[model samples]
Target: MPGNPALTEATYYILLSLHKPRHGYGIMQQTEELSGGRVRLAAGTLYGALNTLCDKGWIVLKTVDEDNRRKEYQLTDKGREILINEVKRLKELARNGEMILGEEL
Candidate 1:
């Protein structure tokens, strides 16, 4: 099991993108769209993160296209749990910030 330490922005988005099965390019596009273009994953970075996520059992290979040499990945149950937890953590952070800042800062 991976620890609950904060996920890097890239890793977080990568996991989010895998909620539906997607190929590397699809993941890249979806991630950029999801982040409003704030995050653009390069090929090497995307593949590396995909490998890591697979090693962690957070994402799994959903399908492979032998003709086109493309692969699609989707989130595992554990991956969804992790993502949900991350959302909860983010919400808590936002709530605390709003409470403290109070439109002043």
Candidate 2:
């Protein structure tokens, strides 16, 4: 799968939150918790990110409630690949930063 170099921080967390299936609100809560409350995504921002991820084939609708009000999404195989690649890239970045700063992080 071709990787997206332009994936934003919000996009990364949003995708990561879907490692299991989750609805929009669930995603928001998990993202905040993951970031220690430093990355709270508003509903609109999250919905927009979800739409973009869906269009990119990175996430898919996994389930819907009987009332059709809650929909859960999960990562596709391609999404997992992308997430792994992003992790690698982030590690490289951290390594480089540590090297330049002369400190371990």
Candidate 3:
């Protein structure tokens, strides 16, 4: 949907974050925390990913109640599927790579 999202770890993290219905900054913080600082979603990148996922029908803006400043997002069924597929792909790649490398050494 988002043009070979198959190669994006950040995308997966973003999707995972929205699985719990979180705001933009909340999503960013959660994603970073979950990845142990290995991943940081910048404002630009986060919005871009959100829009892309929305266009692909994977995610949607659940609600917006900008008090001081905030908006939340939630994952659609399609989003869950996308995330699941990405995880499976990652596992397969890891298995294959590990086997080949271990055998060679």
Candidate 2, residue 57: lDDT: 98
Q: Which candidate number would show the highest TM-score if scored against the true structure?
A: 1
Give the poorly placed runs of model 2, Cα more than 4 Å off: 1-6
Q: Is candidate 1 or candidate 2 better by lDDT?
A: 1
lDDT of 3 by residue, 1-105 (tens): 653457476788889988799988898899899999999989998889889888989888865665755667899998898788788888888998989897775
- Model 1, stretches more than 4 Å misplaced? 1-3
Error of 2 at 98 (Å): 0.8
- Candidate 1 per-residue lDDT, tens place, 9-91, comes to 88899889988889899999999999999899999998898999999999998658788777799999999998989988888
Model 3 TM? 0.83
**How many residue pairs clash in each candidate at the backbone level?**
0, 0, 0
Decide which is better by lDDT, 2 or 3.
Answer: 2
Off by over 4 Å in 3: 1-7, 64-69, 103-105
lDDT of each: 0.89, 0.88, 0.83
Question: In candidate 1, which residue pairs get closer than 3 Å at backbone N, Cα or C atoms, i.e. clash?
Answer: none
> Candidate 2 residues 1-105, lDDT tens each?
465485688988998999989999999999999999999999998888899889989999866776776789999999999898899889888888989986545
